[model samples]
Target: MVTVPELEGTFIEVETLVEEADLSEGPAAVRGVLAELNISEDAFTTEQYTDAVIAHRSA
Candidate 1:
């Protein structure tokens, strides 16, 4: 879990492996599951997290 102090917000990222062709259905599936559990996205991001992981591995 990570926190954004200024926004007083917190979030946990859930990841799944999906084929490139299934990219569209992937998000739909995730959103459907989230909706079933009453969860929502306030600020969804992939670029930042991907960059962070790459930088950390290089470091």
Candidate 2:
């Protein structure tokens, strides 16, 4: 499962693979998924997403 915390100024699409996969190999799988969707790590920061999530939860 992928957990993409929302950010105020950035948008990210979430996806899940139906095939069985090992959790230990999830990093590479996530990278592949991001690449497939053209997503970048620099697109959103932890602080930004944390703030967004907190604001959303409070609301």
Candidate 3:
């Protein structure tokens, strides 16, 4: 996995490829996998890497 320069740490990204019509199911599916991996919902981040990088540079 590539390190996120802005965040200064490598991150894990879990994704579910649901169709646009089924977009609502994406989060629940990913959450299930994360739960299995022992990752709690409280640690989940919705911020994209590009957004993080921009914010870091702006700061």
Candidate 4:
């Protein structure tokens, strides 16, 4: 499961994968999670979000 840690100045988002699912299911899952969180698609790049998650965990 994916865990997106909270960032002080940014929205937190994450994508988790289940062994039974395929990669194609990722986008829709991400979109649904983002929608639920009210995050706009253009607000953060995949790379940026990834970095934030890493930084938060390491901190």
Q: Pick the candidate with the highest lDDT.
A: 3
Give me the overall lDDT of model 4: 0.70
Q: Write the per-residue lDDT of candidate 2 for residues 23-46, one digit (tens) a residue.
A: 556567766777777777666344
Determine which window of 10 residues in candidate 1 has minimal summed lDDT.
Answer: 4-13
lDDT of each: 0.65, 0.60, 0.86, 0.70
- Cα displacement (angstroms), candidate 2, residue 4, comes to 12
Where does model 3 exceed 4 Å of error? 19-24
Kindly indicate the candidate among 1 and 3 with the higher lDDT.
3
* Tens-digit lDDT track of model 3 for 1-59: 46875588667889789999999999899999999988888878888889989999999
- TM values, all candidates: 0.47, 0.40, 0.69, 0.52
Model 2 quality (TM-score): 0.40
- Model 3 scores worst on lDDT over the 10 consecutive residues at 1-10
Q: What's the distance in Å from true for residue 19, model 1?
A: 1.3
lDDT of 1 by residue, 1-59 (tens): 78644333556666667899888888887777666767766455564655655666687
- RMSD of each candidate relative to the true structure: 6.5, 6.3, 2.2, 6.1
TM accuracy, model 1: 0.47
Q: How many residue pairs clash in each candidate?
A: 0, 0, 0, 0
